[model samples]
Target: MPRAAIDVISVYVRKAQKQRSRLPSFRSLAALEAVVRHGNIVWAADELGVTPGAVSKQLGSLEEELEAPLFHDGHRLRPTPVAIELAQTLGVALHLLREGWDKATHGLDTGVVTITGNASLCMHWLVPRVLAMQAAAGGRAIRVTSLHTSDTWWQSTVDIAILRHRRVPVGWESQTIGTERLTLLGSPERARRAAERGIAALGGETFLAAETRHGDLDRWLAAAGVGADTERRDSVHFYVAIEAALEDMGMVVAPIALCHDLIAQKRLAAPFPACTIRGAGLAGAYNRAICSPRTAESLFRWMKREMRRCSILPAV
Candidate 1:
């Protein structure tokens, strides 16, 4: 608990650790861990179920083998430089082992998938595809969480993600799930109102913006070869933008595939041609490494299957 005590333990354990020519066995490592915890031969011996004399003899052997004095401060034990490096490395490796076991035993894949995504992707595209995935998988449950912040929710320890960024970070793997083609999705009543006034009437109404970079409005207008007037624009993130549109606040660009079912149900309708984003590929993202263990492979296969079924693009 005390800072000095932590430093002492850290030093000596590292020292005892470094004395070995090769990595220590679990028994030896455990002895080292015990010594670090107890801080002395007598205490380490009692905790490790070894004689005090034996503990002292082992420590001496370790130091001799490493040819490095592990304890610092003649009055206080110190770990040699080599010992410190070994301790930190072993600590991380041990933690990784524990984490691997935890992920394996927990039936995490049989349960929810904490997928990070914006509402527009969820509502228009993923929600339906997941439902289809659930139906085919038989008995697997899927959970979709909303990501509303400009900060990446996918950066969290989520199970999977439908990201919307162009670059995947180092050490991470990504897969192209599908592309977002922009088309106008209006609430049924809103479509009727616009129809009476003519399609150009949309130019006069305050449109909902998808606020984030590469959002629906930005992608759509860019795809359509148009730009915002800049003099007047209303912007909001996916969830807010969708809610506003549902409330008939204003029309927004949506992917045709995402809104097709709603249009059939007479809840939503597309007023424009579907087109790929201007100067961009279809707008959306997916990382391959984040799936839950059980579904990771299967869902990956399903995702590929679904994307192919819906798209003409070659699998990546």
Candidate 2:
């Protein structure tokens, strides 16, 4: 063959090869989201009870399908911009679809929907409205799990997750309950006495922090510019710590929303002024992106409305 003709043939073959290569299947997208949320393929695999290699292959498939890498962060399993964008866009509808399909084809039940959240908050702020949601959603059961800061629901079968967050995530839609400020909560007498001298005078006060809290200390510090140092302390679970502090025993820094009723009732008091915490409060977000059941979607919407009607998102 002539040299030029041979070169043209090679170029055509390469172009053909590129088009023939493909990416992953629809199932792999689920794996990609699982890996991003959980923080590693191994953890994702463990959560899914599948092999790491299988997770990896699914991830590879997703990347191929997208024609770009989904994740490229250092946290081993965190999402890249592409992944975050994709998750934000695709998470809700997909999960809802899956759930709907499962119920339609696989004898799934729409009878009960279990939700998990911080225990006390759920009991006090969220539980009262369960019946209203059930009524609105065709008598569906809404079970509340309180005191949950992590994904304890991973071990159990759950329909939805509801909790507090500083911001509604980009991928998920949320309904605002109400807003509250953060206060350096303590025994009112102690805080008043501490205030008399100076703000930092309570530096040696006992402190309590949540296990996997979001912006607990930062919001507290930013609110009052907290520089006080505590002399003695214990690292109890967040709920326990808050409960103890509310009893007027010690000091805790928490969002006022979590302690609002008690504070108004004089059970707890603000160590600093109310305006300090900026007060842009939390709302309830349904991770519709991650769930795909029509019944669950029905339940999620019903719950959000019930929350609004019952004022569960914000205490009022």
Candidate 3:
């Protein structure tokens, strides 16, 4: 072989190796990001469109490259401090990447704000009144997706979220839509029965509950000065619980705003008038974005108005 040919091949190989060494594999980085974001291997696998084993392998490769442990091995998986920090930075970077992609695909402005939240809120509150979103957007469109509050993976999909909690997420802008006022709602007949038999009698009546809002009934009963029996009850979704109440299955502690339409239609009645649950409420939140401030602000305003109109709001 010619010495000049050998030299050329050697230079090309060196250049390629250097380029590869400078850049971390996106696959490994993505796996690590997903694991950190979700705080687990199974969920990270779901997010990355792969198996848990695949995610574990990627994490192992990443750890070997970085020479650090990212997660603690135990009964419950938890991210290491370094992993948490990396995840936070990655989330911001992903948001920026999304912004760039948005600009490329939809141009500088599209006026679309995607929202996600509890399914009950979506069905009972937003879905019925989505025209309000259209009106608020002027000519722009509002997209909504419903998910269980337990599912935090929606972060990647939604521009804003209407969480059933008051905690303002870190690194995000939040508007308190309002504190949800509690009310003991029931069928009109049941309300009449409670009114006639006296409100205290409801303490012994069958009640519907939700797994998530486990102690709400107890809290409301305590406030009402009644000792709840807590027997002869069934658990279901907030929407389903309301449906059962409408069917005269039992009484339920529901948000007044969510029950407004039913109350207006006379299908459901609040035996106990609306009352506030201290330190509890829903919030609308979005990532900080410079280009769509007006759009996000407009939606936030609309959310506040809706909450107020339905009496879900408490003094902020």
What TM-score, computed on C-alpha atoms, does each candidate reach?
0.52, 0.47, 0.61
Which residue pairs in candidate 3 collide?
none
Candidate number with greatest lDDT: 3
Q: How do the residues 1-316 of candidate 2 rate in per-residue lDDT, one tens digit apiece?
A: 3454355335434654777743335557677777777767788788777899998888886666555677765655556666765554446647788888877664444456666666656654557667865775567677777645544443555445555663434454555555544567777687677678666565666666665554566566555656634443455356777777766667777665556556656666665654345444445555444433555556556654543443222221
Model with the higher lDDT, candidate 1 or 2: 2
Against the unseen true structure, what C-alpha lDDT does each candidate score? 0.58, 0.60, 0.72
**Candidate 1 vs 2: which has more TM-score:** 1
Model 3 agreement with the true structure over 1-316: per-residue lDDT tens digits:
3454355335434655765654347787788778877777898898889999988888887666555687888777788766666556656667889889988655524756677777778877887877788677565676778877467634475677888765544666777788777778788888878868876776678888887677788888888877866554656566778778889999888888877777888888876674445425788877654225566678779878887788642221
* Model 1 TM: 0.52
**Which window of ten consecutive residues has the lowest lDDT sum in model 3?**
1-10
Question: Model 2: which ten-residue window has the lowest total lDDT?
Answer: 307-316
Q: Flag the better candidate by TM-score, 1 or 3.
A: 3
lDDT for residue 180 in candidate 1, whole number 0-100: 48
What's the best-to-worst order under lDDT? 3, 2, 1
- Can you tell me which runs of candidate 2 are displaced by over 4 Å? 1-110, 128-139, 147-152, 163-180, 188-200, 278-316
TM-score of 2: 0.47
